[model samples]
Target: MQDEPRPDELIKAVADFLRDQIAPQISGHAAFKLRVGINALDLVTRQLALSADSDAEELASLKTLLGKDGTLVDLNSDLAERIASGVVDLSTPGVKDHLWRTTLAKLAVDQPNYASYRREMQGSESKEAASS
Candidate 1:
């Protein structure tokens, strides 16, 4: 009898199939579109599976920074307010900078690399036009 494939093996097989068979035929923007679609779906799945404990380290660090003077709720509110007002200077070396960078990195990962791809496409178009 054949054994069932593990989940990791199944995921890897699907990724391999996409890379070898599917992505190769896609052209230009289509390739980036497919890659972004897959990345978005993967991120959604990961976010759905996140646990309450996932932010434990960040929460601990926040608590240490805030100290015993205020409630966690108040501290969170104040932090958001300061950040929104641009009053919080993240350029300085501290926990605030760490938090800002972590949040920004997550946002950066979600952004599509379309600007660079668009420029490349435009360059190709201009070259083709000139040649013709």
Candidate 2:
């Protein structure tokens, strides 16, 4: 379809250029806006790279929790109904873990460098090691 420097690579290159070159050279509101733009580009690049794996994992988790198969929107609706009706909840087996992992997956795509996300990731790894 397309050529070498793929979409994600192109997006990353633009964001990196803004962050490493333009942003540092600018000042005042322009600098702030430039950084914001760069962050948005970076987030898009991360999403393009990570969304497939995260969506697959999320779908699998939803299937396991709901005990059925459907599109992501359908499964999400089912999960919402179950939560709303008190049929299942965080206390229910697998629900909390599924929710946490899903949240982490989302954070990885939207804000991988976020401090709280990094902390939670380390905590999860430690918990897994302990359980194993």
Model 1, residue 72: distance off in Å is 9.3
TM-score of each: 0.43, 0.88
Q: Please list the residue runs of candidate 1 whose C-alpha ends up more than 4 Å from where it truly belongs after superposition.
A: 1-13, 42-54, 68-77, 83-94, 100-132
lDDT of 1 at 85: 83
Q: What is the C-alpha lDDT of each candidate?
A: 0.58, 0.91
Model 2 residue 100 CA deviation (Å) reads: 0.8
lDDT of candidate 1 at residue 91, scale 0 to 100: 58
Q: Taking the tens digit of each residue's C-alpha lDDT, what string does model 1 give over 32-93? A: 99777666555554443342233554455566665534554576676678678877656534
After the best TM-score superposition of candidate 2, give how far the Cα of residue 96 lies from its true spot, in angstroms. 1.0
